[model samples]
Target chain A: MTIEQGSYESPIDRSVFDQFAARLAGDLPRPTVVETMTALLRQEIIDGAYGPGTRLPEESLSKRFRISRHSLREAMRLLVHERLLVHETHRGVRVRTVDVHDLGEIFAARRVVECAAVERASDDGAALAVVRAAVREGQQAAEAGVWATVGTADLHFHQAITALAGSSHLDELMRRLLAELRLALHVLADPRRFHEPYLERNDEIATLLERGDRTAAASALRTCLDDAERQLTAAVAA
Target chain B: MTIEQGSYESPIDRSVFDQFAARLAGDLPRPTVVETMTALLRQEIIDGAYGPGTRLPEESLSKRFRISRHSLREAMRLLVHERLLVHETHRGVRVRTVDVHDLGEIFAARRVVECAAVERASDDGAALAVVRAAVREGQQAAEAGVWATVGTADLHFHQAITALAGSSHLDELMRRLLAELRLALHVLADPRRFHEPYLERNDEIATLLERGDRTAAASALRTCLDDAERQLTAAVAA
Candidate 1:
């Protein structure tokens, strides 16, 4: 009998391994299974479901998610690429530990890339709307004391700004870096310590872009990044 | 038979896969059978064993690598996460296509990261040697008319320069971006079309660095990037 290569079109069913892959035919919709799985694990990581430097068992996750071990492994590999998890050969996968240097580098790269995107947004009015909405959402989240929501909204604000640059390539690179940055923020001493000031700084940077002052917007963004870096560094040290 | 919750590390016989990974793991090596397999595939992509947009069959690769289908699949998952390969479920994995737009974004991100590293390298004399050696190697490869070798050496040059910035985090990001860039370059027509001018530009930038002209060095680097972008765009379109 010829071995079937598996189905090419379908949303990866949560049931069987081959079916799950068949589902991932083309571009998946937002909030797809992989994304849902990512969000769940992200919350768990932030909530300390798994401690830093702790191995995450594939078998256990499979049972917990009610999915096959194969699907769970695929999810883990994605996280491993994101720097949220570290996969060791015989040792198994574990939550990645973020140190002071890791934080510094992440923020440094973020500042350069994000600030450039903000500058680009000033030239494209359409992109500014997305950034403005993200800032508004961030403010609302901060007022409600939803630190996790605020952190995520803050990323959306910047991501919207980058999208204004009209480069899918830049967006892809920025998205990966932002994912790692968000994961690092999750490990800070108190979530509010990082998210609270971000609301104000994001507003200032957004306002600069809305007013079409690209230089001022970029400078404000740089300062905002500096503040975030300082806070993250202090939190990691503490 | 009951499966254990955890398995101990067991000695496995060396396979052809071990040879490449063994070399890669030399400096703080993190070897696992899966990672070894991933590295092998990466080398193949870099070596142009698989052309762009060509579907990579799991069964074919598994048989060729002399590894189990499961192990090969796992490796493919890792590369997919790394953006080295794109997976479309039943359609199988294929080398990712890097268009002119992708190249532009990659270079833009590289400039931001690499220039910052060069600025940092100004204060660290010890790291200058790495850049110097890479420059020499790049020049020699160009002289020998080995465009692919020149491209690979050029990456090492920039990687060394970025490492001098003293951030493992940036180094990691650059590593990922560079791998994608290498694959993208493979599809561009005539390596010599890009390589010849690239060598001259690299020399100019290196000379500026040697003279302690940070401003001039950064400027020269940007110009070189612009030229490279134009060549890549022309090649892709042609």
Candidate 2:
């Protein structure tokens, strides 16, 4: 079965499909077929196309991408390296499941990175603009009742916060952290209830940064992250 | 020529050789030949065996390991993923060079991780014991004038600090950060002068932590990181 047949189906799955259509329409560069496939599969996995513990059918993926099994393995290996997929000896490759233990550790990391980013975030106009734009995107998505897109926007908002620190290394760390976070968040039973409250908090933090109130911004972000971790932990435990 | 001929020869090179001898004598488990090779190469690179920009001789390495070119390639790929080595077209794989820009970004990440780790580090007896042990190791190495071992001890000190945060992810991030740091630090003119003074400061931070003075400990760490970054950036720029 394709990823669309996975246990957790999102309304925003079409957005990922549209990205594929756009890529095929020559809107983006494809360095190699394997890389292109890897990028798309990574997005699919992060977008919750395949829920936790779903076994990926190697034959079907190879056939679906019209690539050789060797190429498919290369793509899967990349995801495996990213910890988004796991290859067990006898079980083949399956989506990695995030446990409550992992959730706690991940949030600990997030608290360290995100709070620090906000504290040191420079008042660069371009960086702050990205934060505002992400907030706007999340607001619009929430208005349209698209929680998955809202989740993506929230990640972008955090990414923008890290960018304000002016360190690509931290930005990359935030990116990977959020991807794992997306996996952990897939366990939440009500996506709308979980994501809606964070939208306003994101805006509040962004506004605090815009006003040069970094102390308040950092404090707000720490609270936001703590609340999120508790909610995610409770959901994942269930 | 082997890695011993690399431009930056260290007295610690013999230490790496000793590890190889011990491995051969079955003092350590060889999970797989490729993994064994990868771990050895990773340690060598981080230990400044092959200095920054030193081209790794694929042919000699394959011969020395008695492994096929494919297995060597797999091992090299792992280091490449860790950002310890870069593979350029037509140039083969060589040790990655950390420039001024990269050094600045790396220290920024370090500040976020290490400082935050100190701020919230638990006063667990075992964790604090690791901190004191690493501090003692650095002091002993410094007294013996083994600056290279001192450097290793210094990294261990920081690694122990992050461990006190009780998150394996941050610990892993610190490992990668410190490896890249070793590459950047290879530019320093005097290893003794660079690592010597930090031994006392390491003791200071550990003492502060043991006293349950996390705020002071974090403050001291932030200052230490700032000074080191300034020194490293100046050396790298030169």
Candidate 3:
């Protein structure tokens, strides 16, 4: 179940959850110890370092992070709120597992959010540049045969699409949604097989945006996402 | 500025945040102490029991909730993630203040979510019934001159609009967005003057949904939301 890790293949210097927490909490002067821990665990979980349903023992995490029990508990609480982890009575915390139904709901949300974003995508050069950059990154990663990087780039691409809305709230929501999507993607048997086809579709959507055909872009993206959702749902169900 | 309090006027027996937390975390056997405290405080903040920017003293909340410092800290962290509270250095956690820009961003998100939901509203009678019931509740509350209830009903109505999409993710996202909007609405000098005009619009949108005029409903909602964003932004700026 090993997937991509490291900064070279990662899309951003900060984890998606960190960016989400920062935006969500508004501009904070500093990240607390708990926040730092939460971000690391979040990235690790999404990166498949901790597979779904793996228990994160409080004592072990406290030892690993060299943080207090209080701090680790706080970090776990934050991850629970983010839906990256779940806390069960007596059993402690475990990474959340997504099933077929969960995937359907996630894809339903992606369709609503990304479709709306592309339909109203901004004409601003900078926002469009982000969409373009993500597409290039995904393409390049695929060309290099780094499917893990390709997965990260795909998340980045969708995140950029929502970013075009210029709503911090939407960005925050999209971040969480994409993180959940990453979790769902883990069920795939072959990362490259799952992500390879979407690379060209991502490029097509980017091209449509660049040409200012937002409706067409949105339509194309919707069909593509539906197909992706069906694929993922079937994988999870199996 | 006391507005609404108590269960009769409140839209739900459980706070919106509790429902959101429960759904987001998936099914769990029981709610932790931290979860209980977070829900109560979240309701208080959204209901105007604690006004925006009001610092929630740790010692007092620890006393009031009669929970340990650790439990309180965990609860506060959850609220901060939900954007109901913000933690500042040395100053401690305070209710999040929504400024004019924040209101604009929030409204932008509402437009995206509600518009998308209504545009693809489910044909299921049960779903439409919730929308209709919320509409009636608002109308009745308005006629009874319970402006606070009217305000809550409005939140319920929009929530039901998103609920039509049948996505728990959107419902959770809408809960947070609407909570932020509630904070922004606190800026209005007169609650009646602020929410009165929208009651009829809610009914109109509900009617459109009931009749399966989804496109029209979505168009109307987008314009109404735009008008609302403009009005709220002006009020906050003033």
Candidate 4:
């Protein structure tokens, strides 16, 4: 059975997806209605507004989203392709569940990509700019006392780490991995309890890279993610 | 400037995408039209039918694919999102151009994910079976002298390796990265020259994993990818 509807916590609501979407959207021509709808639903799933194993009855969702059944199906189909949602004829559609084991695996995968990024991030000024901006954004969010905003910025920080590797393909892969990460971490009721401690570690990550001490920075990040995964895994277990 | 039309060599005509679609479509339910069309175009890109930097004129593609412009746009949007196609208001849409430097970054990313997958692949019988199947599939394709199919199977072999890690998220990331790898390798007219050498290495990788020698397997795959990258890079340079 599904958890009580009142218990759902969507990461999309915290503007993590929105801030990034707006930043990426940047008036990049006209977006099709289906494209817009798909992003919205994906954000909902990422936010944990819809938990895993919960059936997504299309008839009701289409009505609620005020889109035609055809367009809603397109959006749902896209998410299913992305593995955020899974479809089985017998089961219809349900959000993919992120479990405790998933948390550990995602952390491990993150270490592989993000650590490599830390060690090999481009020294080009443009690449460093992206990483620096992420740190600044996190700092500003912390100063504003918005822990959730800080959480979103923390997601950006890891993304910037991958950017250092300078492969669009790797960057895209990291984007999907991080999305799954936020989804898995959605289980924690108070995200502040999870993200608060990492703020300084993020700065240190940036500082190490800035000074070109990639070896130490990577070691720090590996330790940082290990601790984060352990804490989140414990939280998920509870 | 556009390359000569004679220079365009598409991968889809080999029906690489079609064979898989027909096989998978049986198990899966109705695919949305957009999903179907996206698959078709993506196959074309992978097959080198739509060579890099070639414009995808929407009106023409809609007519060619025998789908509505609306559905065709949806398909194009998906590919663009995948970086197989890029959208521009002025130039319209064109297949993404992968260059020499991209070749290096992709290989670096592959080494991180694939080597890590080697180290962490689960020892359970079923997991090994998946990796075993991919290797066998490649061997069969090579025996039949179907280099393209071998190329496709090679793609699956990496997928199986990642599956050994037992992280669905990692598997998904590997799938995307491998697609880019195939697309990058798409440029070589004689794929045989590129893929023929790797069949034995794949078996070695599977053997190492099956024997539970994760460390040696990881080291072997690292060298495997490094060598493959060098060969591909040299070919691209020519």
lDDT of each: 0.72, 0.80, 0.82, 0.76
lDDT of 3 by residue, B1-238 (tens): 3422222122233344455557546665667777777777787788877666777777766755456878888889899988888887677888888887788788888988899899877798999999899989988998999998998999999899999888999999998898888887776788898889988898898888888999999999998889988888888787
Order the candidate numbers by lDDT, best to worst: 3, 2, 4, 1
Candidate 3's error at A166, in angstroms? 1.8
Model 2 over residues B153-236: C-alpha lDDT tens digits? 999999998888788888888888898988877777799999988988999998898899999999999999999989888888
By lDDT, who's the top model here?
A: 3
List residue ranges in candidate 3 displaced over 4 A: A1-31, B1-31
Clashes of each: 4, 0, 0, 11
Which 10-residue span in candidate 4 chain A carries the lowest summed lDDT? A5-14
Ordering by DockQ: 3, 2, 4, 1
In candidate 1, stretches whose alpha carbon ends up further than 4 angstroms from where it belongs are A1-43, A46-49, A119-122, A161-169, A187-194, B1-15, B21-30, B115-122, B187-189
Per residue, candidate 4 scores C-alpha lDDT tens digits across A139-212 of: 89988988878988999988988888877667877787788777767677887777878888888888888899
Clashing pairs in 3: none
Considering only N, C-alpha and C atoms within 3 Å, which residue pairs clash in candidate 1?
Answer: A10-A23, A11-A23, A12-A20, A12-A23
Q: Which structure is stronger by TM-score: 1 or 4?
A: 1
Deviation in angstroms for A36 in model 2? 2.7
Better of 3 and 4 by lDDT: 3
- The native-contact fraction of candidate 2 is 0.65
